[model samples]
Target: MSSQETEVLVVGAGQAGVAMSQHLTERGIPHLVLERDRIAERWRTGRWDSLVANGPAWHDRFPGLEFDDVEPNAFAPKERVADYFEAYAKKYNAPIRTGVEVTSVRRKDGESGFRVETSDGTVNARYVVAATGPFQKPVIPAVVPDTQGLAQIHSSAYHNPQQLPDGAVLVVGAGSSGVQIAEELQRSGRQVFLSVGPHDRPPRQYRGKDFCWWLGVLGKWEMAAPPKGAEHVTIAVSGANGGHTVDFRALAAAGITLVGRTNSFNNGTMHFASDLGRNIAAGDANYLSVLDEADLYIARNGLDFPEEPEARVLGDNPACVTKPLLELDLGAAGVTSIVWATGFAVDYSWLQVDDAIDAEGRPRHQRGVSTEPGIYFLGLPWQSRRGSSFIWGVWHDAGYVADQITIQRGYAAHVADVPLRQAATSAQSHTELSERIAVTQGA
Candidate 1:
């Protein structure tokens, strides 16, 4: 097979890879980015048709580049986000090879580099940056039984509401994807049964400012991951309808059936955990906590942001939470489709480096530096901070990783020069000894 060489090989030409390339280019690092598909492929293909960015444009972009012709406060469409990344890559002239899939990456035998096996050819690189962001694989719960005739798809594959079979839909999971799809289906005049789960209900806007603005001012974006046991609680904020807060009660009032955690499907009956009320209560508490923190921060900093009373008010408990429906007959409800917005799984099976992956299949790294030299990871959730996985945040993290790579290179060069330095010193001592011997003979 054909072989190519580069100082660095960045796998996956999405935002993370492109960002890393930009930083590496700034450092004059000769790197090649390999992508299985087009640049920003996920944003182009893996999202629902109506999906918009979860954060506002101003807060979610890389440095020195702004969303052209898009309002700062407005959430750009997924297509626009993809276009932005493509434009950014073009502007920097990132060395990206499209449709090149790296099948495996391993240490080169008896060498100080890596051998990357790709579909097109083999690449030898001194350093490899695994820039494949999270969401490598879509995961559907095992609880989803194999039922014939019920069209089920992960949110990644979902396009528009019209794509599903004409019937009531059961959306499992209440994260951003689940909630957004549920809301869209409901608005499309389809009965949506949303399985409510543990989630944070942060308002889209507060006090005439976008929620992202609040998070930025509060320094919440830079905060570490949520405390253990609450890591599963995803933020339920959406950028649809010019952006708005996601309220379960309001959704219930709007005709979407709010259900508890989907437990299992057995014998044509869908069982749900009796935690609807508790789940809703938890989300409400999370919502209030943000508002309270914002209020406290405003007062402490003497900021003039006004209070939003409507945001703080907890609406009436939906009947689903009050008198919970523990079970639902899918057939009776005419539920012909199931959208598993259950999120994605992390898979790094292709990385064959030793001591680089943990037992749980997560990258073993310190702020993106792997235990194995010359190997690194990028765009992992909380890789350095909570913002590590975000769009703009990934850019910052990539710069840091690039800095680490530069430091490592300098160190390696210094170590490589040690033997030469020692050899020169030995030669000078031998020459002095020879001259002394000759002087002794002459005397």
Candidate 2:
């Protein structure tokens, strides 16, 4: 196979990879971006027609481009976002090798480089950026047993509700994707059933402030070191307004029925959690409480005011009435389609890196730097700040990592930064010493 060389090799050409490529180009660094398919293929092919960004347009912009339109704070459609990404790639002249499937990435021992073998050829690069997003794989639960008669499709495969067969369809998972799919199917003259699960709920706006405003105020978007006790916890909470919110009241207003969480499936019927409504109610309340606390904190801090609070009605409490998992008896309900809005998973089998990822399948990185030297990760949830994984957040992280890359290159005479393992130990010692000093002073 032909061989090539570059300063860096980016594995995916989505938002993160494109953002990194922009930074490298601006810095005059030589980098090659390899993509398995055309850029923004996921956004183009993997989403539904009615899907809009869960966050506002401002939250969806990349490094140099702004997603400004006449409607401020509006949800941008998937196609529009994909178009923007295409424009971004063209604008930056990103060195993208499309249709090149990367089969394996093997790091060379005793050398600060990696061999990336792709369908086209092999390339050795000093650094590798795994810009392949967390949503590389579609997650379908193993408990969802085989259905010989029922026509089932994951949300990834579903483009429109019209693709489903005739009859009542059961949608498993109550996340944003699931809710939207169920709503769309119901609107398409099909009887739709949903399986509830642990989900977050926040008002579209609170006191004249958008939900993102509250997240910004509560340090949820702040880039601080991970909390002492919450090492495993990721700070970035999904913005409530951007995705589908099951306004139970609105659903009731529209005459749509609610159902319980799916536990298992057997004999063509799905089992559900007994306390599904109670769990959903508790989840909604808990999210609201968090937002309320955030609002209170913002007010106390004397942040700038936008306007008077807007009048909005919270959804009805799901606790008053509980519904068992509405098993769509396909024959009786005439169910035609079942859309699995179950979330996604990350697959790193192609990359030959060891002990670099955690048990949860998340890369073990302090701030984008993985355990293996020269193997860095960006655009992960809570990678740097709360927004690092976001379109806006990637820029800042990219800049830092770019700087780190420059320093490591010895192009600039700055010392290479210490690894996360060393940094964490130092931080722990500093905290211990501070506690001792406080005790002595108090005594």
Deviation (Å) of 132 in candidate 2: 0.6
lDDT of 2 at 202: 58
TM-score of each: 0.92, 0.81
Q: Pick the candidate with the highest lDDT.
A: 1
Over 4 Å off, model 2:
68-70, 223-246, 294-320, 323-331, 357-362, 411-443
Task: Look at candidate 1 and give me any clashing residue pairs.
Answer: none
Candidate 2 Cα RMSD (Å): 8.1
State each model's CA lDDT, in order: 0.86, 0.69
lDDT of 1: 0.86
Model 1 TM-score is: 0.92
lDDT for 327 in candidate 1 is 94
Give the Cα-based TM-score of candidate 2 against the true structure.
0.81
Residue 70 in candidate 2, Cα distance off native in Å: 5.3
- Clashing pairs for model 2 are 54-242, 54-243, 55-242, 165-336, 167-334, 167-335, 167-336, 168-334, 168-335
Models, CA RMSD each: 8.8, 8.1
